[model samples]
Each structure stands twice: as C-alpha cells, then as structure tokens.
Target: MVRITDEQIEQWRRDGYVLIPNFLSKEETEAARNGVFEWFSPSWDDYVAAGRKIDKPGVLAFPWDNSGLNKAVLHDDLIDVAERILGTKDIHLRLVRLDEAHLGIKYAGNPSNNSLPDVFHQDWGNNTIGPHHPEDFCSPAFFYCLDDVKPGMAPVQMVKNGLEPNPKNAEKFICPGGSLCIYSTWTWHASSEFEAKEGHRPTMWLGFNRNDRMWEGGRFFTIKATGTRDGWLRAIGEATPRQRELLFLPAVDDEKWTDEMIDGMFKRYGKHGFDPEPYRQAKAKREAQTNGKH
Candidate 1:
C-alpha cells in the first residue's frame, strides 16, 4: 500500500494536484499492460488512430465500461488511492482512455493545432450542471504512465495551483514509469502532443467521479483516440472527514473534532442548503452503522 503524509495532503489542498511516483509496482503495471490486450485488438496502436475513426477524440477517450470491459476496471491499487483522496464510500469509475498520438489521425478540438482551443477550462464549466455540459462534481482523476516519457514524446502539462491560477507555463510532468499523477477537479491540465523523441509514449487516463446525478463524471466515450495502453485503473473511496461529520461516521467518531462541534458547527460547517435537524439525525443513524463515532 502507498503511504500519504501531512506534506502530501497539504500539497493537494494547496496545489490542487500531487505527483506520486511508482504508484504501481512493476508487477502491477505489467499486469495492467497485459490486461487490456488480453482481450481483442488488431494493432499495438489504438484502432482509432490507425485511421479507424474520424473527427477524433482529442485527449479524452476510452473503450469498455461496467457492462463491457471485465475486471480491469477493479484494479486494486487504484481503488486504495481513490479512497484516501476522495474520502467517500462510493466512487463511480469514469472512462479509461490511453492517449498516444500518431502522424495520421484527424485533430478535433481546433483544426489549427497552433490556435487550438485547448487552453484552460475547468471540466465543470462555470461550476454548473445542465443540458450544455455533462461532467459535474468530478473530484479527482488518476493519470498513470505505463512507459518512460522523455519530454516531447507526449507529456502532461499542468498548472501549479490551477484551482486559482497556474503561474507555471505548461509544466511538463516527467514522472518515470510506475508513477501516477493525482489531480483534483480544480486543477487545469492538458496532455502534450505526442512526438516520438525516442520511444513511443504510452499513458493511461482513468477518472473517477462522484455518483451524484449532478455530476457527469461518467460521460460517454464518443470518438477516436490514439494508442491504447490496454491497461486499467481502479478506485475505492472512504468517507472523508467532512462526510464523516455529515454522516457521523462511528468508525472515525473518536477523533477529536469536539472543538468544532462546540462552535455552532451544525450551521456553520454542514452543506449550506440543508437543514441541521435532519442532518444530525441522519448523521446519527449513519454513525451507528459505521462504529467509532465522534
């Protein structure tokens, strides 16, 4: 299991994203690599980029789903990391896409790659959910690199504190093999264009969104993508500190939060729109179910 420290947690709260190296072991990484191809596919490259589909999917794409791609969707390590980061019991696995562009495919976002619209926009446009855009309330995502990415051969460019403003100019994340990038919904990031400096770039994008209808993290896979890693990432979530307080999680109840509890926290800290009475009762019931209540 991976260990997290106060520094890492603080970094996430402050920076909107954290870099974790070797998130998966060589064995696990290999297992994921083999898992995708274990099924069926014609080429080492994705069926899409091989001129299979036009009007291509930019950086986001995938294959398989809850009803399709079998167990790779339940990768063990991915689940553990999600649990620590999301702090909720329910995690809805989103799309799994491997991005590795070749010379042939059609670019979709902005025809003129030089003036592409792939600038900066939070997945939740204006932080609202409706008919226009679907993805809402998606908290975090796991970007795993299956191979060694040497700069130009397709690296991910992320802003430093994107929840606010990214002073860094397209920071290229050069994480070696067996590492994963953990990013919250607030961070603004982009997948760099794939250029084979030495070896072919192979990366997997596994996203998890909250299971709320208001959140469309589970958006549909609708276009042609680049190379396919043929691997999978999994996710599991544990109740967060906020969730525990809202649900009165007995499992974590013993922790000293009394200081906040005495300060009119019921009105101050809970969801802004809900009533405190129902929340407390619901919290009590949920706490009784979880053990170690606060």
Candidate 2:
C-alpha cells in the first residue's frame, strides 16, 4: 500500500490534481489487467497474441464481477487518499469503470485520426446531475493506468490549474502501469485519439464525493445501484465494511443501527453472507452503556 505524502497533498491543492507513479505494484497491476480481461474479454490474451485489431472500444461500469479490479478500486490506500482529498470519511462511491482505448476510436466517438476539434470539458456536468454551476459540486476521482500509457495510447490531458479548457494548454497524463492520477470534477481534462498501432491501453477510473451532499450524484447513464443486478448483490455480499460504507451502507456505530434494522438487514441480505453480528454487537453496546449511565 502506498501512502500519500504531504507533498502530494499540497500538490493536489495547488494544481487540482496529482500523479503518483508506481502507486500499485507490478503484481497488482498484472492482477488488475487480468481481471479486466476476465470481465471484458476472456479471450483477450489470445487476441493480443494473434495481434487482432479491435474495432470497438471496451467499457464496463461499476459493481461488476471483477475481483481484481474491485480490490484496486476499493483499496484501503485509495480510499484514504480519497478521504484526504474530499476532507471526509463519509464519502459516496460515484463511479467505477474499465475504460479502454480501442484501435480506431477516440474518446469523443470520432474515428481515430479524424479531423475533429479536441474536446476538453469538466466532469461536473454529469457528476452533479447538471448542477447550476460547476462550483456547486466537487467529486475527486482517480485514473489508474492498468497499462503503460505512453504517447498516442489515448493518454488523458488536463489543464494544470484545472481552469483552462484549451487543448493547447493541457498536460498529458503519460505514466507507467500501476500509476495513478487524482483529479476532481472541476478539472478540465480530455482523452486523446488512440494512435497506437497495436496492443491495449486499459485504465480504471473511480470517483467519489461527500455523502452528505444529496445534490451531488453519479453519472446519469451508469446502472442504478438499487437495481436487481447480480453485480450489485455480489458487491454487497462480498465487500468489506469500508467498501460497503462507500456503497451507502451506514457504519456499524451509526445511530440508525437499531436491533430491528439489524434483524431486517439480516433477513434481506443474509443469503449473500451479510453478517449482522457487528451491528448487533454495536447496538448491544450502545444500549448497555445507556443503561449503565441511567
């Protein structure tokens, strides 16, 4: 696990973003790449070995059945850094995805090498559900490179000050595999056209915001979290407490954790291995302390 230094935190404050190289180990990166292939295309290894050219982009939204990607996204170190940037432990998980750069496509849906103006924009529009102003929302996000993103591999470019939306003034995020770039919804960033002749450029993106802000929400097109998706249930069942908390599950010590609620939750999610003992113990402790005090 990598620790975010004071210098990195200061850098984030000054530039609205920070890049940490080698944040994830080589082993971790390989696991993530394998996980992406497992979920996105099980035959990806064979395709790559055969030098097959892909015509379409590869994308998978959050709550998918990819444990490798899930571990990296919900990583303890990643969450700590997010809390530090967002200034709260009570954070909502906004987005998690596998965004790959394909051979003939660009970020904005134009064919690669097409004569089109570079598109640079802030994420606040989609993140905040079209807030009245960009300033009204702030969702800190992480872009983790699962592959070495060199020039022409669809590297993302962002304005240094997070203010300018010009292509000429943006800095490209060219980093090695296992690297991470932390940016916010306020940052102006754009993905470049994929120019690499072959191979894959896999990246994972995760975003979060303060849980208290109801107005600040997720991207509109992502699958609803409350749906009967198998991924949703798997995540809820298998996730750790810290991970579950980001999914809007109240902490064990939260005031809302009553005996009745605990029992209800056990009934609802018990089939998926949802353990209620933590909540049960917490409630018992709270009641015991209250009785003793009275």
Q: Candidate 2: where are CA atoms >4 Å away?
A: 41-59, 96-117, 129-137, 162-164, 219-228, 263-273
Model 2's alpha-carbon lDDT is 0.66
**Residue 168 in model 1: shift from native, Å?**
4.7
What is the lDDT of every predicted structure here? 0.45, 0.66
lDDT of 1 by residue, 223-245 (tens): 23222333211111222333333
Query: What would the per-residue lDDT of candidate 2 be over residues 19-62, giving only the tens digit for each residue?
Result: 99988889898887776665554333455554553322243666
Best by TM-score: 2
TM-score of each: 0.52, 0.79
